[model samples]
Target: MTESDDIRSTLIDMLEELDDRLARITDDVKHTQEPLAKDSEEQAIPVENDEVLDYLGNSTRTETDQVNRAIAKLEQGHYENCEACGEHIAKERLEIVPFARLCVRCAEKSEE
Candidate 1:
């Protein structure tokens, strides 16, 4: 009903989607190095198994950390405020990046 609830619900939905995709990546990593029989086709995947595993692990960690930070911001009553300037974050920007920590102006300045 309220704007905060809407944002929270949206973020939860996004996090759930990320979790599902991360689970699939985990499965892929688990099966990437399946033992091949002597007669089985010796096919090398385009990416190295170790590299894929590392990449998947890092990606999952990053996503989880971002989700956690968003949840933390909500709990701390800072969800709609920019961390850098303490200004209210624009709804448009928040809709696009629910985990954003800065407003457009501050974000642009920081990038410079």
Candidate 2:
């Protein structure tokens, strides 16, 4: 299969995994609304639980957004190029992060 097809498949897999994780996070936070005695003991701080849930929610949103952007790039016919420098992103990097938007050099520069 072509590299585009492989990355497309990877993005699909990541999206599915994210969906499952978000669902589980939702379930975990929802059930804690009325914590049982054992659960209450296990979770000494309700605020901590809330914080964890919030963090997970934010992380899930970010990942979902990235995955969607990757899929859009794939559809737009430039999934292999860096959005910032118009250079081809390394295949190795794309294999690791299929939604990457910058080549290594540009990405490193942007970090500065």
Candidate 3:
């Protein structure tokens, strides 16, 4: 298969995995499978776990959005260009992070 096709497949797989994780996190945070403990002390553990799950859910959702955007860019024939500086993104970086929108330098700067 062509490189873009391979990358598209990888990104789709990542998106599916992230979606599954987000669903599980949502279910856990909502206590849908089991009710919260009646004992206050026992309840604290699940509450703390829910906080972590919430954070993970948010992170997964963000990644899912990025993957979707990357897929769109790939289809538009603009996937390899950095969003910030319009430079060509390194193939190595793309291999590692197919959903990345910025080059290393621009990404570093954005973190500041």
Candidate 4:
């Protein structure tokens, strides 16, 4: 297959995986909070579990958003360019984070 076609397939697979993981996280959060789902207080939830679930939920949501943006960029033919500086994003960075929107230099500058 062509490179563009391959990349498109990769993006689709990534999106599907993200969606699956997010759904699992949502279900876990719901299951864990089931005891208090209606203010019954019939059962106590563990503090550590709550914290873990909260963190997972937030990270999953953020990752999902990032993947969506990446898909959009891929569709628009701008996935290789940094969002902030229009520079080409490094291949290494893209390999590590396929959803990255900024080049390493621009990302560092933005952090400051």
Best by TM-score: 3
What are the per-residue Cα lDDT tens digits for candidate 4 across 29-112? Answer: 777765564565544555677788789878877887887888889889999999999999998898888889999999999899
> Top lDDT: which candidate number?
3
Model 4 Cα displacement at 81 (Å)? 0.6
TM-score of the candidate numbered 3? Answer: 0.88
Off by over 4 Å in 3: 32-34
Q: Return the TM-score for each candidate structure.
A: 0.79, 0.87, 0.88, 0.79
Per-residue accuracy of model 2 over 1-112 as CA lDDT, tens digit each: 9877877888999999999999999998888787568745666777788899989989998989999998998999988889987989998998888889899999999999
Off by over 4 Å in 2: 35-44
RMSD to native for every prediction?
Answer: 2.4, 2.3, 1.9, 3.6
Screening candidate 2 with a backbone cut-off below 3 angstroms (N, C-alpha, C), the clashing residue pairs are none
Looking at model 4, residue 50 earns an lDDT score of: 73
Screening candidate 4 with a backbone cut-off below 3 angstroms (N, C-alpha, C), the clashing residue pairs are: none
Candidate 1 to native Cα RMSD, angstroms: 2.4
Given candidate 1, what's the lDDT at residue 49? Answer: 69
lDDT tens string, model 3, 1-112? 9999999999999988998898888877767336756764665576677678878988998999999999999999999999999999999999999999999999999999
